[model samples]
Target: MVKEYILLIIGAVLVNNFVLSRILGICPFLGVSKRLDTAMGMGAAVIFVMTLSGFVTSWCDKYILVRYNLEYLRTIFFILVIAGLVQVVEVLLKRFSSTLYSALGIYLPLITTNCAVLGSAIICATEEEFMGRIFKSTVFCFASAVGFALALVLFSSVRERLELSKIPRSFQGPAIALVTAGILAMAFTGFAGLGS
Candidate 1:
């Protein structure tokens, strides 16, 4: 059981990374990654939202959707849960850390639509291995969120350094960033079989 959980964490965080491997939440992965502090903030927000939503959505799936045979409503239900969670995060961030909140700006609100959060909830609720198991589902969600943070932080670090590097004018902005992201994604592919 312990080994199983470890593998699950490894799988989600490395092999099936939401940002790097699955390419789910490219919006913030790119937008908020311009600065290390903002990237860290976004990663923390995503971790909070995804983990809580996984817990809530897992229970909702088991006690509400699956119990009522309303699996068809999973997507809509999950979105509502995720959106609500994002709002909570936004409020807290606004109240406690105005600087970080302002840094996040539009990207903070965009967490509502971040497929990574939604995808984590949906996966927790639907995956046979996690269905009806709130703890396991939450663990998976947390692991996936950590993966997102890891990718975001690494990318942001690289981008920060890129700010000082001299590069061809043609590849100075988004062009170079996209190329770096591709390289990062390819590097992640090396972990593909580790969890298995």
Candidate 2:
């Protein structure tokens, strides 16, 4: 059981990264890749939202969706939950960490539609192992968020360097960034063999 949960965590984090393997949240990839600092901020915000939303969504799925035959409303319900949660988090952040909230506030609103967060919730809620395993679900969400942050930070750093480096006119900016992300994905694939 321990090994199985560990594999789930590893699988979500690297072997099946939200950004790399899953191809979610490309909007942020391109939009937030200009600076490492902003990327880090966005990543932190995502991690917080995804982790908390995952736990809530999982509980809803198990107790509400499954119990009430509301499975068909999964997408609608989960996305609403995520969006609502983000709003609450944003307000809390504003009240507490004004500076940090300023850094994340702009992105927090955008995270409502971030496919990666929704995907993590849906994946964790629906997975056989995570369905009933509350702890495992929480861990999986946290792992996925960490993987996203890692991928975003690396991409941002590479993009920063790419900006300074000379490149072919045809393969600059977005094109080069896409290629870089592909390479990052390939590298992360190596983690598949670990924790198994």
C-alpha RMSD of each candidate structure in angstroms: 2.5, 1.6
Residue by residue across 44-140, what tens digits does model 2's lDDT show?
A: 8888888898888888888899898988899999999888888888888899999989877688888886888898888877767777666778889
Residue 61 local lDDT, model 2: 87
Which residue pairs in candidate 1 have backbone atoms (N, alpha carbon, C) closer than 3 angstroms, thus clashing? none
TM-score of 1: 0.89
CA lDDT, candidate 2, residue 170: 99
Clash pairs (backbone) in predicted model 2? none
Q: How many pairs collide in each candidate, listed in order?
A: 0, 0
lDDT of all predictions: 0.88, 0.86
Q: After superposition, how far is residue 59 of candidate 1 from its true place, in Å?
A: 0.8
Taking all chains together, each candidate's TM-score versus the true structure is: 0.89, 0.93
Candidate 1 residues lying further than 4 Å off, grouped into runs, are 88-108
